[model samples]
Target: MNSFEHDVAVQATNDDAQTTKVNAVERGYYEDPFVRYFARKGSRKSPLINRGTWVRVQAVYDSVDRFLEIYRESSCRQIVSLGSGFDSLYFQLQKKSLFREGDRFLDVDYDSVISKKVEIIRTNHELRTALRADLTQLTNTCGARTDQYVLAGVDLRVVEDLKRVAEKVAGFSLEAPTLVICELVLIYMEPKHSDAVLNYLSSSFTELLLFNFEQVGPEDPFGKQMTKNIEARGSPLMGLSAYPSAQSQKERFQKLNFNKVAAISMLEYYSKCAESLQDNVKLRIRVFLVLELIRMVKLVQEMLIQLFPMVAQVCKRI
Candidate 1:
């Protein structure tokens, strides 16, 4: 099927009567096995698109675990996942016992989107009942403890509601550490929203940030292609504006007075955990120019030239 046709076909399957086929628990952009299975079920004409979809899924999740690790290490009891979609962070943390007695977990997502998820979690015996049982046992096995857990539906783009919940949960004191994960959400907004978010996080939260972003500047070939594919899939590319070049990203944090700033290419992050990735999964990460703007940029530039000799020729010509 053509791209639009494929999207239509996917949408058709979401009709009221047809919806009974999937059940409450499995309804998400990525949750449906068939959508994923077939979306990756490639044809000769669009192998790249299929592979890219798989890569996108893998990249998002790969980063998720990494973000979770940061959360675990922050030693913060309170955890907030901004723009938490079908993210399994809370479930994973619960299973791993990453939070202590005073730690609180809150998931902020759009009301409509989260309502569906909440319904699924509420109705599905597995997520609420079976999965919890399984995780509770695992938590016991791992000795990971938590004081409290809560999932509140809020729009991250709307600062008022998000701030209210944050204040209520963590309070304005900022005495205890709070880990806030914005993940891939900010990119959907204009740069102004991103600026506000960065400033808010820096001021309101204490200690540590795990930010994952993309760059869509005119200079990037892969980025251009990636944006085309995203829109082709019939999903709004709202977050495209949020990605910035390495220098721009560095300046953003610096503007907000972030105490310690370290930047890593998505490629570097993937490489750091390469040994741990599963065999069935394939990961392709490129942050070509973005990484070039980090501390000691010249050194990383020299290394990139060594690793990608062809790029060096292209750069010299440019």
Candidate 2:
């Protein structure tokens, strides 16, 4: 089966394009030149979808920021992004001065994705300078790695492959305080595969923080249609049925022996975090516009609520 990961990247790029056009930088959404290079021209997303993406990006950024705040005194800090796709969070964080010295960012994905990303990085001076990578040192299979950044390829289903990629390509340390991001990636995998990846992380990393962002609520009308639609497209949400709600997602981590786990739906996040941002007046206005758009398209709103209901969680391993 063809990996549907590229589709997700395209959607994100489209969202970034829309968010950039609307000047929503405060929401932590960025228009990556690499993404723009691959994005289809004239592609646009609905305002509500764009706002939801904005909220999602903000939630992830805030989680990472909180992690940094807690580990500011620590000598080693790292971020490992699974299936990083075309997202440029690492570069953006560096640009915003959030990433400090002695901090490492690693991005792992399928070989094809990593190859294209490396090509873009090699061609773009900004990305090359930010990563401090020597283009002469990179290959299609093994990505460029510098003091602060590492990009490598991995097949998440294989434990040995993950280990090799981490140890050989990325030189990741288990002792470092690491934040593992699995945004919108796990749902595409089989339950056993995703569970294996989670179990490996849980066992290997001593001080680990996991941030998972994905769709939930599979029993709802929207979820049913969403699953059907995606399956019809030949890309099923293989793990959704196993962890279909916020509580279930939280319990999954607790069962894996995480020290602490907290999960909340996107609606709750929007109410508490997104709407309460005092500094971003423009973001607040965009939230209102999304609500109004929701009212105008009730059916679309229902599908959006049901099919796109995202659960974000922060899990800690002590």
Candidate 3:
């Protein structure tokens, strides 16, 4: 079935994301033991690609971590990942104990994607064991649930369908602190359709934190190239032009009646993430030492190249 927000080409992007994430993990940009299972073997990526992938991955992980920390005393909490495809967050959180008995982690996506994911979970012992999942009771169009986790197949544009799954099926608490993650999912649909979903979330949930990581600035040169490339693949980012920058995102959320809203470009987000880490004295010292060692190595290499050449000329003349 064709999803309102994610179609075939957009579905394929899941594998691309997986490959890119696995590449970043392999290169020590981050650590994700579960991502490799969802990704097929692929070629190595450039440092820029790795860093970008790391930024996106780390953003969601850190966001979830902070949310859990802030809402630790709450009786109920929920994390809803829109268009979650082969995402490893559930497994990661399970290991970290951040997503425990009282907190719900729901993954929503197209029926086909969830079906395949359920099938994979059935066969993959590691994934199945981690979630303690049973595929025998998979919903006809949705997916399975184990303990605090639920995977539902529902179109985001249809607010009623999403409401049914979230409220009745998945048992998401409306009064709970909720973290809604929509990474590169909404931009596939027209602004009207995406706005409907956004409106539904902003209004329905009492306490909500919606995190969206999406492409913006289709008019810029780099943005134009990105748009052209994705369009060539038969999936144009329709909402990109509507919400073309971080400021636009913030304004859009504010117009939706969100009390608190902030948006930053990917580079700015990366810098802020680095700055947050630098607050830790141990990490700051380690980073400083690493940089100093690199500087010393470069200096020694320079001396060997230039000074050694001059010394060889003098010895030959003697």
Candidate 4:
């Protein structure tokens, strides 16, 4: 697997670890037991990192949950997750009663990553039993198709590969109201490739809600350092230059032919959506002095706003 693909597993490990904490930001619905097995030593993340992860998770979850409310009245509804590496979102949605019996949830990633994930699911009795999938038939394949969940391996740079996987494995319909998620995935790819994917999605899906979560503000020192650090680890942020700010991100989708688009930075989300969850944060950092807590929150907000800011964009096809 490439460095970027490996990074997904690392993020999953961190999410699993955070879910096990006493006052986790969101209770992990399916906190996979195999996360610790794949995680490296010292994989435990700091509270700041965990909180950031939680914010992203919560934002996406809320968006999907909102969509499902309308999806119930629609004929066909599907969720397509790009570069979905060991994320338990499908399971989580099922637990939350958001995933219906006939709805399709497709998780696409590299062949190597999907193979490992399928093996993990096969060996884990809880995951296997929950999906009602046959463990014996899941081996030696880059893709696995269950009743509701479809895990496929495809190179995201190739638009044809995505179309083929969706048809053959996921049985995804273009006319269906679909939620397309590209979380921290496109920034790692070249701008042309990312653009091609976005253009394809806009043209292919009639009723679509596309959400992209990625780092913005690449002109700043913190963004430069974050880019350099990832490059040092052999995964460069190639698309950051194409959409370095929140406005640029919103415009990117507009130019791609999405009818409606809105982008919000992590700082704005914290100022708005996070108020409801502040009590959990307070409990987790209770040991800190009052001044320290205030200072830390401000520091985190400033860092998120100026430095490694994350932008969440919602784009809809008319």
Candidate 5:
């Protein structure tokens, strides 16, 4: 496929993710009040899909929560969401009054995606009131700045574009204490582009916590099939083979001068992080399905995880 068509497919992954999130919520996996507004109504998904979505949401959410609580005392902190699709975490967190005055939440994505989101905010009462975003100055390219929120239609491959947006948006800065979230974002780009982006963030931030979620493990039978499936769908995992393991992903951040870095898989995260009876009870069905999938597929020659939940890490920049 051509670049434009490939980009459209890449953008559709946002819908795929949102659909999964909506299904997860409908299935009682988590509480996300704003996802419904963006996700189109869809039929309930399998226990496996719901649980997989829950793992992604829970891991990233936990990392963001930890960062906010740890730096709650700091002033004018920022949360920057790269390739932020229809995610509503900022609005949800804002409802709970988690962000103090001067703190900003910025969501950056492609122009087409951001345009639709901007229109949704303009038309939706809850969204407009929650963010208090004034869209009077909305442009063709899709960008709006408010006291506590920023929506920018950006091409993330260009570091200068991000720098420009950061320069323009309050609390979004290279030197500021920033939590950079990139969920399923990096795998779309070439390694050189993504590496440059990471290096820029690493070198510039006075304090940074990067939460990167993407595909990993492409050497095994399951991984090989997973890679083929993704590529056949038109949007290939361009950067997957380069950083195909958790250790490789961890080292990618550590080499960027991060002081603290750790990467964990979905299976490992479930084993270590799920503490309560409720969580276990809720997830038991999905766990059974996961093992069943292993048995059924012969786990591509062995019972193993194909795609990852993501590298849940504290990737703190020194």
Candidate 6:
């Protein structure tokens, strides 16, 4: 594990607090009451992220739904959500009655966020006690779900915590295909730490993974601006060490041996459901890149040659 300083943790805690205050339903769903209220009350024409990006957010929702649908078809009804931040999907899904009583779903995150979620679920008498049981042995009758699955608080950034929490889901039969989600989280860590996460997830699951991430393109306007903003804020966390391109992402996945690799853009998903949105609201999505999680690998040698002066000289000799 990389040695993270106190400031980083403080900053992350503050950021998470601010983020959790905003409901995902509001930011993601156009028709959410908070979104409508903000639209009516705020002087700003659009949200900081914009409607176009929110349209892209639908790709996340759709991907999760697709994973559940496919896994359900295969008789594997467990869904594991990693780094689940204020996502209302669990409650929404339960409301829709999509999953059978036996279907199991678990959301993992930091303590504070999970605590908040526990309260939200506990309000529904049937959903109470979502976190009382240990996840490492969930299938041991003690953790079985009769009506709805569960939401648990566990940090994924820490490998031990991830393994401890995931053990519950991992205990299930390998024949029971699992759908693991690592959404909008890889960018939070430095490359090496991220590698650990990828390796852990890869080893934990034998079947499927639904991973979502963003790439830092050199020409991306927002990415450049965000990097500048972070630098101005006296922190360089937003700046990427290497511009993680789509090609590199795909290459890593291929190395990991994940098959049937396909790249789906957010643009395609929004286009299919364009009719549901408002006329003034444009549903623009830029998928720009994708890679299967199990097939990906990050080669440090190429990066070293390009970045280090001594390595560049050594490569030129050959």
Cα error, residue 161 of model 3, in Å, equals 0.8
Clashing pairs in 6: 135-168, 136-168, 252-295, 252-296, 252-297, 253-295, 253-296, 254-295, 256-295
* Residue runs of model 5 more than 4 Å from their true location after superposition: 136-141, 277-318
Highest lDDT: give the candidate number: 5
Q: Give the Å shift of residue 266 in candidate 1.
A: 2.2
Per-residue accuracy of model 1 over 164-246 as CA lDDT, tens digit each: 76666434335444555655455555567656766666766555444444443423555566567655655434544444455
TM-score of 4: 0.81
Ranking by TM-score: 5, 3, 2, 4, 6, 1
User: Top model by TM-score, which number?
Assistant: 5
Q: What is the C-alpha lDDT of each candidate?
A: 0.45, 0.68, 0.73, 0.68, 0.76, 0.46
Give residue 301's lDDT in candidate 4 (0 to 100).
66
Off by over 4 Å in 1: 1-76, 130-147, 169-173, 215-218, 232-243, 276-318
Tens digits of lDDT, candidate 2, 235-279: 677888898877787788877777677776666666677445655
Against the correct fold, how does model 6 do in TM-score?
0.64
* Ranking of all predicted structures according to lDDT, beginning with the best and ending with the worst: 5, 3, 2, 4, 6, 1
Q: Give the TM-score of candidate 2.
A: 0.82
Model 6 segments more than 4 A misplaced: 1-48, 123-148, 169-173, 230-239, 264-318
In angstroms, give how far residue 72 of model 1 lies from its true place.
7.2
Screening candidate 2 with a backbone cut-off below 3 angstroms (N, C-alpha, C), the clashing residue pairs are none
The deviation in Å at residue 15 for candidate 1 is: 15
lDDT of 6 by residue, 1-318 (tens): 223442344235434322432333333334332222211232222232333335545555566676677667665566677766556556556556666645667777666665555554444444433233322323322222323355555555577766665555434433355566655555555566656666665555566554544434434554456556645544454314542555565555555445434443344444466666555443321111111111111221111112100000000111
Kindly list the per-residue Cα lDDT of model 4 for residues 1-318, writing each as its tens digit. Answer: 675665564345333433433222322321334344333344444555555655566777767887788678886789999888776677667655677767899989888777777787777776666665563333333678776788888888888888878765578888788888887788878899889988888887778888788888766776777677766655667788887887888778788888777777777876686566557554544543332344366546645674223323333444
Give the CA lDDT, 0 to 100, for residue 281 in model 1: 28
Prediction 4 global C-alpha lDDT? 0.68
Q: Which has the better lDDT: candidate 1, or candidate 3?
A: 3
lDDT of 3 at 35: 86
